[model samples]
Target: MTHLPRRDIIALGLMTFALFIGAGNIIFPPIIAQQAGEQIWLAAAGFLITAVGLPVITIMALSRMQGSIENISRPLGHVTSLLFTVVCYLSVGPLFATPRTATISYEIGFSSYFGTSSSHLFIYSALYFFVVAWVSLYPNKLLDSVGHILAPLKIVLLAILGLSAVIVPRELFAPAIGHYIDHPVSEGFISGYLTMDTLGALVFGIVIVQAIQSRGVSDPKLITKYAVIASLISGVGLTLLYVSLFKLGMLSHDIAPNAVNGAVILHAYVQHVFGNLGGLLLSSLIFLACMVTAIGLTCSCAEYFSQLTKISYKLLVIVLIIFSFLISNLGLTKLITVSVPVLSTIYPPSIVIIILSFFWTFWNKPQHVVIPVTIVAFIFGVIDGFKVAGFSKLLPDFIQHLPLSEQNLAWLIPSFSALIICIIIDRYND
Candidate 1:
């Protein structure tokens, strides 16, 4: 295996961290922690498991596969690969995640400051996307430039927020009713999955791999080694930040009621520590961080499609920006609620595939192992999405009255069954 130079390795690690730490990272954990209260650390641990550990696994899988997103799914055959790639790409980019960047940016950066008029919100968001489109029109070293600048700023703002919670002395309140109900750890574990940062890491892993290849590191084994190390560094940074945010959130419970939103908790914490000026200053930093992330996602999606379709990247960027700007007017609460079902359906299959691919060599023919299993898993996952979104009522009454409807665990049941069947089939075939 060829060794990457130490400096290059460090740079790659920083870049990986930049890719993972976006607006969601800053917003979600605190909300979970505040809600979870006494269970904050448990939830943070669960989140780190998926948010950090799974992402590292994704990079390692990509490195081992030594291919594009399409190639990674090639073990499922050409048609399956095509379908999976299209779904995965669309999930990450234009269809789901890309629009989320704009919506999140508006919620965190502008909503607090802007008036309640939908027209004004749309106008400001349009301007926001216009700037994103302009910056992305010509791909430059701007990703690197902006990443370098904002990465530090993000860290500084986070540190300030964390320190404020530590030094200012706030009391913690009782956990919310559903917060620690049933199994707190399991709830936290599952809620951690909702951060969606792991999925981001998986998508961004391709970018890191390409960056490595661009630097002329062609050996698959060497790429895997560097990617793992880089992902670990990034993961550690993410874990630390999450823990701090969780703590800060839990500490904020005494200051406000349980119904306070995450942004409100954050704003209060900042004001408590730094006063009004400090709150505004932190808000400004968050706005820039969110904008930079939005720009990066827009540029990445536009460039990828441009390469594939020979469409003008500039035009695509403009279209995506305009659409996302319109979408951003939906407001944060609605966006989060609307996105959950879709994510529930899409993310599970991708994660399962990433996990299964690691054991690909164990199968007699990898395609035989991957294709049927993924298809079955996805079918179940889609059913789960429908149930979660309250669409199960659309089914015939008798069908809806089945045992499955009572449990409300559509994917869990079929997915486990599929896994068992796959294992049996693989073992007998081998």
Candidate 2:
């Protein structure tokens, strides 16, 4: 396989970055900085841990693992691979993430314009999803077009937002005293993971790989080399943007004393800098940017699942878009709140698996070691998700009556114990 020219590699990297830096990212960092105050840098560092680091690692893992999502989990057998892929895609796409794109687009984009009418919002969102569904059905040209429009709009709006904060004199607010006192760095780090942009990076890595293949770089070694370079560039760009946004958020506290949420903070910034017209333009841009992301995610999920199940891609895209549209009515805040526990539960196992794959050559019996350990970790992770989401009450009385009932870290003990046992067992087997 001929190596891609350096310019082509950079272009691919930029495309990869464009794919990962979607709507949630534009809103998340500033919120973190606003809440973190003096601890903004600490929070930024933490966010990078998961947001940037994990994503780069994921790309490396994918290149190392080769093939599709199924290939990465082959050590765990076909059923487990299929199940894991389904859960990951659903979590990242329609089940939780896709609807969020629409809801957020509405909240940040149209909410100020449309006001608080549930019926109207539903009708508008239904129409938006119809467009998304249509675009997904004709993905190739549609994605390129929407992406072209949205990517630049995102950068321009954000540049204006960032510049406003940079020019304004910062009057730092007193940091809120809280239980987040002892280990701000660690708290910030974990908080960063919540962005889940890194997870998106991992899922989108396959898309990047395919893009490279389409360019005729089919050699595994060449693919891996270019993928790493591309992911590095993308990760750096995302981390810088996150940091800038967080700082902007911190500064905006002084500018918009009434700004409650990240969306409000952003709106206030635009209004302050550019007045009503600017604010309206910003909102419109956000709507288009978010719509583009939603379309990409929905199409990606539908296409992948359709391939896996041998279903018609058009039918699958329509079904998923309809489902996503129905759920999008839940509203932006609700979607973010609902997704957290699920992400917390699933993300750890996925991260661990990706990390482990880097050392595939080190494990003489990867199936014995990796498969059982991942399953055990996942079982605990699932329980932890339920506990966090307040679903433990639905468990059998006997199960809920177990020793760790009152403890939020109920999954920790069993997950670690299983991991340790698996490592020891694998050592002996080797």
RMSD values for the candidates in order, in angstroms, are: 3.4, 3.7
Inter-residue clash pairs, candidate 1: none
Distance from true location, Cα of 407 in model 2, Å: 13
lDDT tens digits, residue span 1-430, model 2: 5777766676666666667766677777766677777777776786788788888888877876553567777788889888887888898888788888778777778777788688867988898888878776865544244434555566566666666667776657547334235545656666666677656755676666766675678798998888888789878878777777876787776676545567777777678768877767777667666666676677667768877889998999888988898888887668767887888688767766777776667767888777766776677667667776888777777656654444333444665677678778878886
What TM-score, to 2 decimals, does candidate 1 have?
0.86
The top-ranked prediction according to lDDT is 2
Error of 1 at 147 (Å): 3.7
In candidate 1, how many Å is residue 388 off? 3.0
lDDT score for residue 243 of model 2: 70
What lDDT tens digits, residue by residue, belong to model 1 across residues 1-430? Answer: 3566776676677667766666776777777777776666676777778777887778777777653566667787788777776666666665666667666665666666775677766777777677767766755544354435555566676677766666656657566557454455656666666667656655565666765665678888888788888778878777777777777787777665574567777767677667768657666666656665665566666666676789997888887777677667776667767777877777777777888877877777777777777776677667667776888777667645644444333445556677667777888987
RMSD of 2: 3.7
